[model samples]
Target chain A: MSAITLFGILDVLGTFVFGLSGAMVAIRRQLDIFGILVLAAATGVAGGIVRDLLLGDTPPAVFSTLRPLSAVCAAAVCAFFFGALIDRLKRPVMLFDAIGLGVFAVAGCEKALAHGLAAPGAILLGVITAIGGGMLRDMMATEVPRVLREEVYALAALAGAAIYVIALRLGLTETIAASAGVLLAVALRIASVRFGWQLPRAPGS
Target chain B: MSAITLFGILDVLGTFVFGLSGAMVAIRRQLDIFGILVLAAATGVAGGIVRDLLLGDTPPAVFSTLRPLSAVCAAAVCAFFFGALIDRLKRPVMLFDAIGLGVFAVAGCEKALAHGLAAPGAILLGVITAIGGGMLRDMMATEVPRVLREEVYALAALAGAAIYVIALRLGLTETIAASAGVLLAVALRIASVRFGWQLPRAPGS
Candidate 1:
């Protein structure tokens, strides 16, 4: 597949899953329709936008183009109607989000690399892009960002991106490197949840 | 004075005030050194970065240049050391923040217009840029944004931007237009604070 095709698929899937996550938060907060849509869109594209900005890509594709924007809107609508059912299957929903997170992490890394960013900057951008949407969603909803609070959220993304960067340097093909990144991120996230892994909080209460 | 000169000065001054505000919030939350620095930098530059991205300006000046970054760092350091004294002088600080808000609002609008954005797009970007830093700061600190609360905060910025756009369209000098925008925003903010002005929150809320 062409690079655009590969990244596009991952981007859409990530946007949809993130949109669902954001919509779920809005539902829990009893927000109005406008708030729900805003949160959903914010979660879907804010990360990519930030990454694009950092990489000096002007007019982020997510904002100027229509495909990703449409995907986010569609996801928001789906979540709005089926939130109750989705909420009931929390475990499966989380698994989907984990996969989506990995997809986003790898995609962000690859995009940064393609844009000529150095390894370290690309790795940092990958993690930032993976977490930016959810952070924006929580902020808009007046809550703490889940990534900063607990668990190995950003760390998992970071590891995945780092794996991708190393794989690239080691002569792996684009598809293989991307796949490895995705798999690693997803596995780490699932394991963290299953094993109750968490980073220690501040020293005292 | 020239438009660029006026905006450059106001931007630097606004960055300082916002850095102070972000640092104050960080101190109140009792975050670590890293968190304080991040919050300060985010508040100082996040707004302009968002605006530049939306306008398709690559490599935002705040990140590419040293002056603004230095200003943010200085603000963070000052707030870290004298937070108690600054906290005690709440009234004066409030007045300073209000003026900073006006300065940022006008600068954002003018910058957007200078970049060839049409009136509507310019207005929206202006509002986003005016509020972007504060929203990011609050999100980083895990709190609801002050602009979304019970006050005439964002409205003041919006009104100011709108005034600037209108004044420019009416054949006014850039200096005069910018000045008018600043005056209106400051007056509205101060009046809102002094006279208990507030936007109606939801119909029954």
Candidate 2:
């Protein structure tokens, strides 16, 4: 498959899992149907929108394209209906989230690079792309952002994106570089969770 | 003064007040100094950034310049130090916030229209510019967005933006159009607060 097609697939998958995560949060918060849908859409696309905005890509891909929106809707519906089932399968849910995070982190880096952003900008955008949606979701739920908490999540995405930036800078092919980045993110995230590795917190934060 | 200069001044002042609002929220939430600074910056600029991005303005004015950042810093410091004094000047604080809302709402509308957006998009963006920062601050504090609440806040800004859009469509000069929009927003907002006017909520929302 072409790189474009692969990225498209990755975007849809990421949106689906992210949407599921958002819907789960809304469900836990006891929000109404509209609230659940809002959270799902925000969680699925907010990061990309933020990355695009920062990079000056107008109208955003999520606005021009339909796949991300459809994926979000599908995820929200499935999540709402199978809330209990999903809750009982925490491991599967977490695995999906990690997959989404890894893919999005790489994609974000690539998109910023395509927009001619410098490495630092690209890396930061990549991390934002992975965590922005979830951060917004947490904010809406009146909870502390998981990113700002003790989780190693944002740093993992940052490392993954930085790898992609370096790989590309070193003349690696697009697909190979992206794959390397995504793999690092997924492995790091899953390992962190499994090993209970936590980022240090500020005193009394 | 030229319109450009006026707008520059307005943007700085708006950011300053918005930052103060954010710092206050963070302080009340018992966040540390870093959190206070983060919230202040986010609240001061997020709205304007959102407006610029949606309107296809890249790097956002805030990112390209130092004034907005400096204003946020100053406001955070003032809010942190003179917290009680600011609290005592409730009426003045409210008025400054109203001014910020009015100027930002009109600025948002004008920017979108300059970018070839239609009246509807311009109007919506205008309102977004007025309230985006506060909504973000609320989210960071883990509260529902004030815009989505039952308050008449966003509607007041909407009405102001819509007026600006209509006035410009009818061949009004930019100065007159903007002034009219600002006045309407400020008046409506203050009146709404004074009269306790609220947008009706859905059943059990």
Best-performing candidate as measured by lDDT = 2
Question: Which regions of candidate 1 deviate over 4 angstroms?
Answer: A1-3, A139-144, A195-205, B1-49, B53-127, B133-142, B146-205
lDDT of 1 by residue, B96-170 (tens): 777778888887777777776667657656777878898888876767666655367777887898999999899
Model 2: residue A87 alpha-carbon error in angstroms: 13
The two-chain DockQ for each candidate, comma-separated, is: 0.17, 0.18
In candidate 2, which residue ranges exceed 4 Å CA deviation?
A: A1-49, A53-114, A117-127, A137-142, A148-205, B58-60, B148-151, B166-172, B195-205
lDDT of 2 by residue, B1-205 (tens): 9877987897789889989988888777656555566678889988998897776677666644678878988987888778778878988888888888988999998889889988888898999999999998887887887778745788878988998888888999888888888889989989888888877668996
Best by DockQ: 2
lDDT of 2 by residue, A1-205 (tens): 9877987787789899999999999999888888889999999999999887788776788899888999989988988899999999999888888888988999988887787666765775788789899888887777877665534687679788988888988999998898889889888888988999864322332
Candidate 1 CAPRI assessment class = incorrect
Which residue window of length 10 is worst by lDDT in model 1 chain A? A29-38
Model 2: per-residue Cα lDDT at residue B95: 80
Considering only chain B, report the TM-score of each candidate against the true chain B.
0.94, 0.94
- Tens-digit lDDT track of model 1 for A82-139: 7778878889878878878888888889889889889999999999999999988877
Q: Report lDDT (Cα) of residue B126, candidate 1.
A: 75
